[model samples]
Target: MSSNLPKNFPGRPASAPTPSEVPAPAPSAALPKNFTPEMARAAAALQAGAATAAGQAPSSGAAAAEQPAAQARGQAAMPGGPEVTRGEIADHFAQRIVRMVDAHRGDSSRPRLYAIEFPFTDFEFDVAYALAGRLGATLSASDAAVDDDEPARPLVMLDRVLNNPQQFERIVRHINHGQDVQLVCTRAWQLPQSVADLVDATLTIPRFDAPRFAAACVDFYELGAPPALGADADWVPNVVPRDFLLNSQVARSDIVSAVRQSVERRLRRYATDDALDLADLAGMDEAHDWARALIDEVALARSGAISWDDVGGRVILLGARGVGKTTLARAIARAAHLRYVEASASDWAPPQNEPQLGWMRMNAAFQEAMAAAPALFFVDDVDAFSIAPWAGMLPAFLEQLKGLSADDRVVLIAGAQSAEHVRFELHRRGALETTLTMPAPNSQALAKMYSVLLRGSGSTLAQADLEHIGLLSLGMTGHEVELIVRRALRRARKDGGRDVSKEDLAQAIIEQRVGPESQDRRRLMAADELRNTAYHEAGHAILELMRTRGARLRYASIIPRENGSLGFVLPGVDESRNSVTRNDIVEMVRVALAGRAAEEVFSGPEGTTSGCSNDLQQATAYLRYLMTRSGFHGLLSLDRSFEDSPELRERAESMLQAEYAHVLGLLQRHRPLLDSVAKLLIERQEVSGDELTRVVDAYRSSHPLV
Candidate 1:
């Protein structure tokens, strides 16, 4: 057989094929006149396989033609020895071309079969557009896949479009039929079939987290290059390497600014690492302190003053959603001068990949982070990663994290949306010796923050105005406060880019109560549904004011809104506030049951709807805490066997029922107040605490609570 392959190609036939050993093509050969070097090697492999099956021996002329190449790769991992049989040659060719396709193919739509397993769907673009973005090709998409003029780029929307014959055929033709046609799948979606039928070869991308996310953005912008590159120092974000790919398109400053707006837009959920600028950060003193400690530890490790394990291997940042855990972790990394590499739960368990491979992938990711030592290793949404009874992964990941933390040069931080079940797993084995809870800023801090954030938008607010806004937003996370700023900016842009008016600030607060964005597009509630919602929220408002001193009631809304709420009475909790007494717990249960009790009293049981499910759930959860968290339940000794669970349930149910009864009686006595508040809610669609109080006061003057 003749050959043309890379000189370093592994597994050359392990012998010098002497002049007497070469074999020739058969006399009836149908070889083409022109073929690629790769095709020539393939044809040679096939010829050798066929000849070996037929028991043919090599001739002198063929041996002479291929001897040097054979002897060159003689020691490669081929099974057989120096005689160099036809089967051996075919195997060698297979090892070279088939086994190692990925390393050589970078962004080339090569002739191949492969799959890509994404960890999560950050952005699920259309197949045509996604393919165009990846391949640097243009494609015009139509409603029907078959109707598209271009068939050269055969993309697949395997998630939903696979059932469509045209799309399925396109996937098949892209993989099994042609060379130079690349196949692309849009974001993370469930796989329709088992791994075998669907995937040929899966492409695994490097795990991306906030640090790498920041680094990539920095690298792409060339924001700060080495002094040799002559870029301004301020242009560079404080990010270092694990540099993957940089686009270098010289994006317009406004375009880059627009990309940045996405960061602020997402601040309402979690802090984007890129968006954690020190100037924008406010009210996370505890988390920032943790960041400083981690930075100091990293510096200590570098100076040989402490081992990596001694760097306090893990920090568990506990907070509600939209809190600054992710942002704080990123900020710590940037301040500590470490690269950030984030691996998520989805990264550990991707769809379609085998369970074994998933573990291996996760383990490999940790190893990679260690290689990028002096890096911040973060695990985000850890609770979501393992919400089941036993995640089957906790032990291994826990150990891996602990091991990495001890490395003396790497830092590990885990962000939990809530630190409930996993807290023990994190703290028990000393896996995470340190725990930091990132609560919301206090009213005073929030007032100060509001002043700063509002002023950043070129708006001014009086001390009284800031304090009022802060009181109204007392329970909000830092990200939520930032979102209010983002909203004010949006308003400022609308109002000819001037300053944020007081009305703009008021509207932003209203948006926080009812929306993450505009809610005008949602369907309006029917008149009856609107009435039920108004009265339900009014019940919560009245109970919150009369019982908790109007401190808990932030704003009551009857409008359908974000997070699947039909109506809601949001309560404010001090950011620095921790520990609720048993009475506080009981009062909270009553407040939660107020909406349902109101429905039963005024509209009857049939009038109640599924809208009260969340309220019922909250009340049930607090009651469960009373039974289980012995410290709160006043139990001197506890037994978690839960053997008396039935009795516990009965007691909890009875207590909840009594609270419901109590709420019912209160609503009955304040029927006039309830009617007055509900009427105002229906008129205005929202009622702040002061308005609710004023209405209640007016009603009491007309009909006293006594």
Candidate 2:
């Protein structure tokens, strides 16, 4: 049967109705439909008093005003009398016990009784049951007849009628009539003024006992005993006896042995050669040798018995997305013969009575796994766990790590996108141990990944194709490489096992490439932008060539490709040349402005492209460098900080404005060359460096740079 129940004390027997229930107290009938301003103020005051009694904040105005008038009426009806609802009764008893305890503070010799009160609702019942189980107490319904044989454990009343003030009054009367029991309640209801007067001085529930409440629920539901609480004998594994694998020189073999035993116990089933071959299980063999080596190293380390103090307790495999952090973690678990438990940080939350039941279960599992020792607790995507200020039990989670001992065989491996964040959190908690970063797969690694996929599918991929795949997968990680190979296999399967062709691979690469369909469009726009950029670069190249005969323009072209550069000009110059003259700097500025000038003269100002954002930034920085560091500004000779000076900044801006104007006029005079070059680019879409050099040479033959 579902363990659902309401959160309140059972109502009084119908046959013997109390005065609070019969003759309908007259004050309730006279209560207002809505609280008057004065009444609202009074209710707020009462709510505050009640909250203070419960050690919580008062409800807001809307909530305070909406409470059933029956609460206030019940209080008014029992100014000094004996009538009240089950809720008020629970509050009254709780208050009395609190008062007794307060009056007897520091007098432990006095009779001690603890009462827990909750509404009999399903959530409250679960909480009560959990608390009872944790406290090792027996729980009975409020109406269950108590026999002499029943253990006299502390009583917790689950009263459903605690919200009804009339019913609560009778409960208080029952308690007052010499029932030697502590009182507790789940819901907050108005307490009588007399009861409120004594609350602060009398009753309190300690915050540390919250977990006990959680444990109670777990036990009440028979969720099964937490693994931490299970008998140690139950954890023993059926494995063949083996000698202690240890380095005799290491004094910490005892510690290592404990951890090894713990790990072996949990993973006894996977302690075979076949089980160690997880690479094959994962359909990967290109890196089979590497995988085998890693396994062998782990096995050797396990056998060699390094001292516990020298051995690292935790291993972190850090890498960019999809580099097999999880895969490595699983392999480690298999290698160590430990149970692998995977959980995400996003899956945990602060314990709540109802909603947090699942988190409690997880907590139980975590503790159980830890107690089992020598286990691999793989926490995946741990970066997603949130920390909030109001979370009361957050420290408990962190405390679990703090409590780990050298004897504990628990090895926690957490995965995240960035090691920095995880390291920061661990450092803040002082829990970090050892870390290992996984690098992006190199070309050889990519080739291996490809070969593995191909061999697994019984298809052969050529070495040239593998090289091409490696080149294309430059920045990819192990996981991404595997995924790409898997995708290729899927494609091969779709084509009926036909040999995967270069065309098929190219198609896949294009599909995987960013902005595939937009490639042509982007290229077109980039080419237009490049045409203008080429003219600008040509202006600089021509100016330099004229000023310094040795400054030869080797090649210039407008071609659009990845990295967003539209046009480039390569000057055949010494690679070691770093410093340039003032004239050279001026020519560079002229080149920077050439594209803008060419667009204005040939394609009109409307033809200017947004692709010049980078160019403009580069040109501005160069101009500033000249003014500040290179001392190219004719009148202003200052340090690098000169760019920040208003005078130098204005002069630099003016110089660039004048240079751009001059370049624009020069482009207008040479409009035919600009048009011819642009036409060639539009026709061919792309031009080789040689083709561009020929075009420039022809233009210069007719119109010299000078």
Candidate 3:
């Protein structure tokens, strides 16, 4: 074996043979005269197998090679060692090449071309090199010139062509100029469109596994015996260690150990040392199932029981920030026992004056993830990575993304606030095609979270109180609920370490959502102003109850919020209703304007305070939507620009006037009910939905409308 051979040379020695010896060439020798004895030995073993199958006898020198050659042949015939073995990817390519040769024998009608694609492993090109040697083909990376005496051999290009336009053009030129050369492309994502146009057929190789690894080792090294393959030997990542392994003087017995150590050094550690399990993720039923399925499939893939394509590990989690997308990704990594690598898209974005930096950062991140095979590669805020096709870094970014998608060892999980704004190309095949939307936890989900939090805290809240707290925390994320629970627990601790009460949780929710109540404002405001604020909120609540198509009122309060609001009336949307009609729009407008109408009903039109300004703005917005977008006034959907027209302006004024008059008349007719609710609001400062409902129902029963 020669030490001067290229590291990627077919049958390059893993460890050098003694300098004192000259090796014998076997009967199967078919390599060119200048080839190293080591390559000749490997090629001989493969060729002898083919020759023996065809009933050829060995030469005298081949008799000297008989024992070892037969052992090599037997190794190739078995399930796991050497390049020419059945079921090995190299064997499949060999058969394909043989078929192509037979099909094109002595024919000069077309360019003899064969292309195949495979997800690249570290030693994939070596497979091509061995195949080329066995079949008398030319390697693109080989320096040896083909002998002018022999017939031209097929040109095998296992190296990447997409990134090298010059080499691609040369290949295209050779084909177009009627050269008598055959082209074989062993590695491709897909042939470049121009090359695809000329290709007659394309084939794909199966994914890499333990058997593939064993075959690759035999081709690259002179192992004393088949490399010992553990159950998870395939879990070792294929990276750049082949260069070092080929250059070093590692013993045959130590070769697999050295490679495993290199993989261990390259592997990443989980970012969070202590990640939560799937059971810890409450209120995310769909997300739980998604993560669990991934965990199971990943386990199967790691054990070589299935391929990563079967796992389908690339996915994007769509949700608002803090909706637990990151948490879910980490949990999946933990559950599957895979290396966890997380990077934010913003982290990869280029800084000032460095447009190419973004792609470089993204490429580095991908490299790190690939080094750590069986890894969870998470990109947070992936929506930020979205860029226009014309952007300077888009090509490089996509190229790096293409590499990540092609590799099966790294499970890619990306998070985005929404998918609508993400780059359309990012959603193309082999990228973030699988989208999982994580919605904010609803009331029932919130209840489950509260229950979990309470149990973890060693405190108990009555089931009814949990339900109430959950209802009050509607539309909140699990993160928000967690924080609110923490605040409530703190409140309980401050109050002599008692169990968290419903009031404590409710107060925490109020403080978090609306801001703390303004005790200073309550004390400083005039009595008359307080009365007016109460009545204004009361009016909104009353009209909300009266409107047939409006949202259900959650609560009404006269307590000033720290956000500079004198009062607020919270309403919850009915999730069951998927669509709204014209009348529903009118009803919403009436609710928006009810406070102004009530202020005028109590304090004459001139006496109404500026408190109705916000109410008027809300009413105007809803009315604008109704008049323009909803086609409330005419058949045509007019824009707000038409508000300048005299006819449209008059129509808008009449609509507002009529809606206001209608609400005022109702406030007048329901005067007793409005006053009662206002009195209750003034007494309680905040009124619950049940309390307001009771007042309204009592009033309606006593004063039936005609």
Write one digit per residue (lDDT tens) for candidate 3, span 524-584. 6787788888888888898788767655577888888878888888776565676888888
* lDDT by residue for model 2 (319-434), tens: 66687667766676676665666666555654444334434444554554444445567666544443442133234445555555444445676666676545344545345454
Whole-model lDDT, model 1: 0.56
lDDT of 1 by residue, 335-398 (tens): 6666677777555653342334455556556654554555677877667545542275576577
Per-candidate local distance difference test: 0.56, 0.48, 0.65
Name model 1 segments beyond 4 Å from true: 1-47, 50-287, 297-322, 349-356, 363-374, 380-409, 414-433, 440-456, 462-470, 474-476, 479-488, 491-533, 548-552, 562-566, 574-672, 697-704
Summing lDDT over every window of 10 consecutive residues in candidate 2, give the lowest-scoring window.
17-26
Scored by TM-score, the top model is 3
Each prediction's number of clashing residue pairs: 10, 36, 0
Cα misplacement distance, residue 232 of candidate 1 (Å) = 17
Candidate 3 local Cα displacement, residue 704, angstroms: 3.1
| lDDT, model 2 | 0.48
Candidate 2 segments whose C-alpha is farther than 4 A from its true place:
1-152, 155-311, 346-365, 368-374, 380-398, 404-409, 416-430, 486-497, 502-513, 518-605, 610-706
Question: Candidate 1: minimum summed lDDT over ten consecutive residues — where?
Answer: 20-29
